[model samples]
Target chain A: MDKKSLTRRLGRPVLGTVAALAMTAGMLGTGPAKAAESFKIGVVTFLSGGAAESFGVPAWNGGKLLIEALNRGGEVPAPYDKKGFGGMTIEYVLVDEAGGATKQVQEFRNLVQREKVDAVLGYVSSGDCLAVPPVADELKAFLILYDCGTPRVFEEASYTYVFRTAAHAAMDNISLARYMKSKGIEAKYFAGINQDYAWGQDSWADFVASMSVIQPGAKVKTALFPKIFAGQYGTEISALMREKPDLVHSSLWGGDLQAFVLQAGARGLFKRAQVAFSAGDHVIPQLGNKMPDGIILGARGVNGLAAKARPNALTTWFWDAYTKEYKVFPVQAPFRMVQGLLGLKTAVEKAMVANGGKKPNAEELAAAMKGLEWDAPSGRIQMTLGGGHQAIQPNAIGRTKWDTAKGEMTLIDVEYYAAECVNPPDGTKAVDWIKAGFPGAKCK
Target chain B: MTLLRSVPAASALAFAALVLAGFVLPDWAMFLVTMAFAKGLVALGIVGLMRGGLVSFGQGLYFCIGAYVSGLMANWTGITDIFLLSLLGVLAAGAIGTIFGPLLANYRGIFFAMLSLSLSMILYGALSKMTTLGGTDGLNVAAPTFLGYAPEGRPLGLALYLYTSAIVVLVGGLMRGLFNSQRGLIALAIRDNELRIEYLGASVRTAMAINYVIAAVLGGLGGVISGLAIGHVDPEFSFWTTSGEFVFVAILSGYLSIPAVFVGSILLEVVRSFSNLYFPNTWQLALGIFLLLVIVLLPRGLGSLTLRRRKAKEQA
Candidate 1:
């Protein structure tokens, strides 16, 4: 071949490569633009990094599964379709909030303004939930708050477009307290180790209040609020050991919890006291045999009573599929995803009905979300509008047990606590809830 | 002289275009541009350190501090005003930087970077454990407030983008001006040969301390804007990866110009956003791949790429 022909051939390949690269870039850049007509739903959660990955990843998976199921199964059949809207294909834009509020807002704004997503879903952290409500209200975008358990998201400001299906900190905390009382574990000198945030603070407050109410003189000895994802827990463990409390309660989920438990167990922290965790089922099973024996662990919405000889098909299917795919049992995180999808499914159907079979935009979806109720794997739950923009939802508790045959963490003797039992009564909320249990009632 | 003067105008025009695109273009495009500017602030701060031959791995500490401080004030105090909250954040970070200044002055190379990283990690630990301060969960940052008007609930896409662009422009100009000063020359000299600068009766440590303070303030300022822009601040801000990202932005921009840093920041945000949009699970991995490509293909950084191309043209 002549030098000129060789040069021309090289030039052709180079041109091809450049064109290919540019085309790739253009395609990657215009993802949301291409999917504009689809019912765009944005999922904001922690999908990368550490702690959030454990729960947030599962939550995302569960959400994806739900979406897949909705798409696969023609419609939600019966009650779900009674509202008049059924069978609509949806597209989702998943964005990592990176487990931070500011990033969440940035991602949320991008979803609303840039992608022009019709609705938003999936937040694993309470802080993100609280951070996003105002933005959602501003955009008039319907947000299905999932995973974030902070009650403050709805309580402080009313966003017509925002609704949370996940059990709030208060709900989980109050339930744990009731479970503790039921167990007759009245030993005092309480100690707490929680992540520093609304959920952590609120959970600690509710626990203390509920414990004080149920068992008097149950003084909290030490309160250790560690930064989320603390690589080491020896120092905090040492302090907890020194305090020498009879019962130890933690809401430590994600990577931090795994690190803490490993370090604490190695240091023999579990041997000294009974342990109660808010998201116990989620974390312990992942621990496998590493989870210490005899630690009284509690998980959110682990109704042991519901798992008789036979359980609901949805619950059974979720458990079987999750284990088969992820090689781990479904936990609180996965359950939260189920709830989030259920919330979306419910709202979309309702909005379709309200709009007289027309597709609902952000405003219609937001309106449909108010006072939303649906049956989840955890059973039926409702998002009731509380004072300000807070959400009132039910909660449950369960003791952790190792299923040796299955090689998994299972909630054995679980009890479902009603929302009213765990919730703060009108005038007396966190303050009164902390006092010794209804001094007037005689074990009724 | 014409090129120098036109730089600001060029930037202003670019920013105006971005803002206009927020209305005319798709929402996703506007979002990518906004993120690009926001991340640019962090990159510029890193450039300040790089200019003095310092590679900071602890920028996240100041970033987290500024963001969390603003977030806390907004949440606990119910002060929805962005400027006031950001001011409080800057003061908090500046106070800490002053203390950190003398301690870090003598350190150089990896030691300086490692020390900074440790400091940020410690802050992360402290924030995570401090329940009253919102711990690992972080604090909610309110929307922008101009005088008495709240911009968060309004037609948010435009005003927010404008605010971000304004900050980026103001900060970029200030950094550029600083880089052109005598101190900037000294900084360059120190990077070239610190021992010679020290022999010339200059207190290398003192100069470094001043530089560090300035960089810290800029970083804190960036954090506040980030907090306002994002509406949430958490302990993760102080993570080593956060600081690494700022470094990445600086290096990617070629540590050359303020606008280049912003461009790099935007590149990163857009790439990450797109990666997540399509790949879903592997956005971080995608970012890693992109960073590797940038490192191999443009060794002098993206800014240097343009400079080198210009020089090649002149030579030809």
Candidate 2:
């Protein structure tokens, strides 16, 4: 084609397209966003990254199962069988939390501003859990952090619209320490290896501080903090072996946990020391026989085998339903997710009553959830910290035992601690509580 | 000088449009554009370096530095004004970028990219270890005041939006002027033939260094705007993947039209938000396919389309 014809062809079409786009923008500029009839909830979880399999997917699975069941009306157990959240049809908007904190901040805003979800209830990454609350409070969107273990979210700052339904990392390590002392496990000259992030550092600090109180005069040999998701543990394991600690503790999770176990197991680190993991139960099914026997561990709470050991009607229904759905026993992630959902259901229903049976707004939801207590599959959850924004729940610890006939790794000699025994009281920080020798703790 | 003669006037118009947009657009759209504008500034820096034949894989280093400077100042000294924070961010990132520019100018191609990558990774490591700064959890930036007025709700969102748009326009105008100036043409010459430029009595390293510093200033500006809008900053700001996104926008815009940088960034944010909303499980895949389609159709990126049409008109 001639140059003049080509110029006209390209320029005319491009100009037309630009004009069309501008028209669309003008149209969009005028319309105000409205909501749907269903009680929409934005569920954020890791659906596609390193944490997806061990934590995010299982948590997402639990959310889908419980939410769908609630919508089905009769599949759920009593008092909670009212169908969906206060008879409003439950519609979920699932978002992948695989991206980092900044991306999560953007996604959180998108969920609130664009999707118009009434409440958001997922964040496995502690970084995300910490980053999202301020935005949530600013936007006045209700947020329920289901799986992140950072105490800083509620401790460092208070939020009116944000709540976490699971106990923070302090509970996991505190319960671990108390369980060890109660079982009379020797812990002198202890060493720790944990991921270097907030979750890992907090877990290690609590364990050491609690050990100082319970097993007084014990010396800390060394604490190695490798970067999170750093698969290789050769150097850290060698360092631990050299220290020849009487006990070793780690709070690693996800692929990091599995990789650490396999690497450390090969070097017989568990045999050399009374090794313990603060949040290790989720790795049980994946590691199977690879996980060395007699390694002390906690699921971060009374979950999986701990919940099974003290079965209730809710526990039986949840465990069976989860296993029947996923073909594996529910672990810490799914259990934690279920408990959070159950708590939300109770809160939503309660808020509905107060809001004249309409789907309540964020303010009503926050009021309903504050200081709320409800029965969960694991046990009861109470919003008792951060002025009724943070949850404190019972947690358990145990030793790994391989069952030959069952062909699975199981927990034996499991011990569960009451909520008051592990979590810090209101207005007290986790680190301070541990360093203060865990005063006023009720350990029964 | 002729590359984009109309850019100065166009950027001013864009600034006016963006300021008007904040008043009419919904909160979500305003936020999306604000964020995109910030990111586009970072990409603009990458383009500045690209014109001097240097491709940095570590702009996130400056981004994180700027974010932390503004965030820490707010958290520590209680300086909550957006304008003051933006100035500090630009100064801090620019100073640091200046220190590394001459050293980096000594290298080229893959070596330059790798060294830049290492620089960002080091920042990531250092920030991750600093537990006092909230470690990997990072710190929250409170709502920044516009001049002394601390607005809340939609007004705060809109204020941040306007502030970001104004900064982008201001920088975009200055960059356009620089790109068409004598020094800018020297950098472009260095990109095409560094040895020839050196033989022609021009200091190639100096030109490269100048471009590097300019890029750093732009990156810092972006970081400040983002810290204000997102209300959080973490080590992830310096992560390699984050830098990769900035570089992607630079590549997608193709160091051609200055406005195309913002277009590319805004397009990416829009695509990401919509696809993630519709296809949560396969959004990354959807993004990959979209990128592939764009590259196939526009070989020199979206900017080249404008260049081609202009060339055809001149021939006619």
Candidate 2 stretches with Cα past 4 Å from truth are A1-37, B1-7
Best by TM-score: 2
Whole-model lDDT, candidate 1?
A: 0.70
> What are the chain A TM-scores of the candidates, in order?
0.84, 0.93
| Each model's lDDT | 0.70, 0.87
Q: Give lDDT: candidate 1, residue B315.
A: 91
Q: What DockQ score does model 1 reach against the true complex?
A: 0.38
Give the alpha carbon lDDT tens digit for every residue of A1-444 in model 2. Answer: 986566545644654364346435522643234445478889999999899989989888887889999998878888778888888788889999987888888888878877778899999998899889998999999999999988889888999999999998888888877878889987769999988888888788888888888889788999999988899999999999999999888998889999999998889888899989888889888888899999898987899888888998888988889889989888889888888888888999899888788878999999999999999888989999999999999988888899999787878998888999999899999989998988888877
Worst 10 residues of 1 chain B by lDDT: B151-160
What is the DockQ of the complex in model 2?
0.51
- Cα lDDT of model 1 by residue, B1-316, tens digit: 2564565776677667656655664554555566567657766777888899998899888888778777777777777676776678778888888999889989999899999899999987777767666556666666767667664443454666777777777777777778888888789899999999999988889888887887787778778877776666777788787888888888877776666787667777766766666676687788788787666555557676456546677799
For residues A257-339, what per-residue lDDT tens digits would candidate 1 score against the true structure? 88888999898888888888876666655677788766555455543222321267666666666667777566667777776
Candidate with maximal lDDT? 2
